[model samples]
Target: MKKFLATLTASSMLLLAACGQEGEKSGASTSGGGGGSGDKVIEVWHIETGEREKYFENVATQFEKANPGTDIKLLRIPNDAFKQKLSVAMSGGNPPDVFQSWGGGWLKNFVEQGSVTDITEQVDAAQFHKNAIANTTFDDKVYGVPLGISTNLVFYNKEIFAKYNLEEPKTWDEFVNVIETLKKNDIIPLSLANKTKWPGAYYLMDITSRLAGPELFESAFKRTGRGFDDPAYVEAGKYIQDLVKMDAFNPGFNGLPYDEGGSRQLLYTGQAAMINTTNSFINNIRAEAPEFEEKLGFFPFPSLPGGKGEMTHVPANTGPVFSVSTKAEEPKLAAEFLNLMTTKENAQIYTDTTGSLTAVNDAAPNDETMKPIYDYLATATHMQMPYDQTLPPELAEVHKDTTQALFGLSMTPEEAAKQMEAKAKEMLDK
Candidate 1:
């Protein structure tokens, strides 16, 4: 099964590479001069492509205009290649001035190694969401500026809910009732694309939040407790299997590809009642089925009965953070660019283009369809970063692989927990 998954991923990457080659200048490119006239060239690296890349370029152009004698060199890399390239550059003492980061253990490693600079004074923490700032901060010092916030929740079709007389569920039991009702009505209860694995992992993330609360995961991440072997972790896997047993996901869900619109297609056509995904999904729905946007309703993950997790706790994280390298030629200019990029005006430009949640305070998109997300965030008691981002890379991969296997019914919940614990222990012991 692992070999099969590897083949699938490689094939996908090959196809992506082919597409990227055809659109050479668009998806990835480097822009800047060699060196001349004592000009300060601040190199910036990012993984966003298409309109997102364009947005960053426009902002860079704006910053250059605002600050003469400093060239903001932009290097756009494909997501698959960006991380490796950045790691190599950083380790080789030639890192970019600013680069994309998903803050957590990943950023902490750079922080501890002194590859990234501490920008505590340059940033005003109060200008961003607490969760965003927290994600980028380490040891009481800020290392990066958050670009956006992402929350995973159940997005439902309002028309389907109204037809079935279902209200937004507050508890796990009520959530199950909605699922059963949808299934009885011959509608797919949920739309999922597990081909990439991470989409399916969201289920385990939300369930774990409900079953064990944030402290258990944090303690485990900090290497203080049972780690992934905790009973709560096992129980979260059981809930995922429970959903699988109930036929909660669409047919061929495990085989579907998210980037290819397999799952969003189901919801757009009303074949599925709901989809568990993040704010990034909004762009897909709008592009595929613009008319259906009005029917989309966002709700927080329902709480579990007698659970230690707060109902207000959410599985969320800020999107890619922009961090300056400690080895930059012009650290001050790079720092200034970071500030320029995160200003309310520029942040809103990102929110407007992507329909995603921005990290800048009061910068949430004003679209009515996105209002529910903001409303939920306003009262959220906690923001649990996605496990794949918060956990060490090796353990994170194990989490994804095990959760996918659980979804496929190839492994029991307890077995999945044991596998995760074993991997966590092996990695930490090394």
Candidate 2:
């Protein structure tokens, strides 16, 4: 369980080191494409590999073929490596023409540094969902185009629920009862792997949204009226601890990983009744346990009584936001490539090939398993970006770490909330 340590501070340090140095020019060829005369090359860096990498390559080839004398260089980097490499590139003042981003506080840093280009005029904002566009926009200016949208949901084994004569819960009390019933039946109520830390964060995030609503959470993160030490966050952590006391998650969940023979395996083997994870887990079910796919169903996080948030306010955000660099050799052409990537045709291809929802308004999944997700996003009033993506990198790490501690019973809810507030004030109060 190696932690990914490429934080905003690491990138800022690199930026400081490279300052006043004559770094290589932006859009310069590093590996791909031939430097032929009179050719316009748009270098794009992304963290897509395997089948998804092939999709990007195909798009580049198509774009190249359609526009002669233009080269679309695709640099596919692994997830962990991409963060470090992209940070170094940004700091060195030679960023790619188009690059992948998560488009919250991460992109906001680059935008504030003038490292990213604003394509608000060129991009048709009306073509995307408001939530998708909202993630990429800063200070009322659009800095990127979102490729797809993703959200967290509770995926349950319908067969297990049927065996216990249980139905999906709509309220917190009902959800707790469902958990107690599963526990009594000797079923693990939730399959959570928190070794990487982010998995456990979903609980606190969803609970906070339900209890305090999005406004208070936003204000806390932004260091406005309320702060992270608010009773709401502590209450959310207490709720998670209550679940822990109920033996809701698999044994040694904090030591388990999400991939391979871990929490997901528990669900596949029918040892676990449910898993609260992102919609992407649907793909895992299809790939790893096709037989279990039929038994899988999903539902929104149950609402809390007297909560300020609506059930429609989901914990979600755009998948991968692509932005053109301000240092791009051909800024207009770079913008064009981004536009091409999200077009209805390419978006449909993205959806069909990836089994995920694209940010394009017209492109949606037609499958029975995925249609509910599409419907959820269609009606969602607020798509709350994950804390790890929305908060500054350092603060985000504290969040994950504290949430993991909460799940492990290593820290009290009040202690965790205070720690988070202390860090938030140090980082955000300036």
Candidate 3:
């Protein structure tokens, strides 16, 4: 069933690519040095800006120094422009030597369209975490190498929690009590930026996994049973509405942007008590509110009573992955560059500079506050991908849009579930 779903997703990608996209080619540029005499230039497209951009540039410089002849032409694109630009580039038959990817459905599309090169025999698959490897694998072959990994959790201000005498909740009921207490004390309980829609979908993903367990996700993706209209999905919607009624989220959350210092600002400045987000959010804190360092704390999303889900189960993925493009002028060199980027030395640099966990076995971030969260993910029994990214593109959008409307009080839990189920059926039936 999983194989069938994968094939279906790949076919859909082929259809989209063949249809062609309409947009002016993006105005992105390559800034790395040209190759040595007689050496090949490996063009790379990545979606890292600020500190991470410099980190990758340094990695490329080291790779060129070691390889002597191969030069990396690195092009950094902003996240909003990345997908469309990459798609157009591939459809136009000029894919980069290496590009950033999220694997799962996103990579599968490129693999089907022959935009990504298969590197199963060229790289060591065992060096990365098992979950990380799985995300980049299709048809028993590796198409990309993981750069780093991420896991989601609730980041809170310790000073605020202690000020209210609130303990980190261990179960759903206790979590609700925490929210109610924070509200009574006139504090926003959760920092959410739903203007982008993806933020709200994370909450639904967390609760749906807890209420229904991971098998429900697999079933939905594979079209085996019940699908998105499952009782658990409806229950997840109800949970979000309950939080909404308690005034759990920050003001104008539905209009706030995640990247522009919306929720992170709320937590850093103590306008809000907690944020349920990915581990990389620490980087935001470091950049925006370095003074809040000692006051921050991390905790996994709490479990519900009688829930079959493990508290140790986390929504995690290898941070953006790097894949060699099949159309690259220097595919081997591109793959080699990818290999160099994952070396222990480079991986550690990634951790030190980004404050994000690495998929490399020993490359946990060096920050003291981030160490415990990295250690926790190291032993997690299950690492689930964000549901929206896991589903086919159409259905993923349905999940995102429906969840946002659910939060806006425009749809009942049942209505949202039915909408999601309808989209799932439309895609799966074909």
Best by TM-score: 3
- C-alpha lDDT of candidate 1 relative to the true structure: 0.83
Cα lDDT for residue 20, model 2? 40
Give per-residue CA lDDT, model 2, range 1-430, as digits (tens).
1234656668778887677443432333233433322379888888654445666777777677667789887776655556677889899887889999888888888898899999998899889878888889998899999987889999999999999999999999999999999999999999998887878999999999999889988899777899999999999999999999989999999988665449999999999999999887766666677798789888999999888989989998676789999999999888888888888999888877776788888898877878888898788888899988888878998999999999999999999999999999999997
Clash number by candidate, in order? 0, 0, 0
Give me the displacement of residue 105 in model 2, in angstroms: 0.7
Give the per-residue lDDT digits (tens) of candidate 3, residues 1-430.
9999999999999888666532232366556743443367787888876567778888878887888877777888877678878888889787778889888877887887878889988888898888898889999999999888888898888998999899999899989999999989888899999887888988998898888788888888888875889989888899899889878898788889776778888887788899999877877767777788789887889997677788777898676799988888777778888888888888898888888888877777777987898889977888889876667667778888999999998999999999999888898766
lDDT of 1 by residue, 1-430 (tens): 9999999999999999889655743555776533222377787888765556767778878877777777777888866567677887778786878888889877877888899988998878889988888888988999999987888889999999999999999899999999999999999999999988889999998988888888888887778855887989888888898999999998778888777788998888899999999877786665667788888887888998878998788888776699988998777788888898889988888888767778899887777876677778778888888888877777888989999999999999899989988888887766
TM-score of each: 0.84, 0.86, 0.90
The ten-residue window of minimal lDDT in model 2 covers: 22-31
Best by lDDT: 2
At residue 395, what lDDT does model 3 achieve?
A: 79
Tell me the RMSD of model 1 versus the true structure.
8.6
lDDT of each: 0.83, 0.85, 0.83
Kindly provide the TM-score of model 1 when superposed on the true structure, using C-alpha atoms.
0.84
Better model by lDDT, 2 or 3? 2
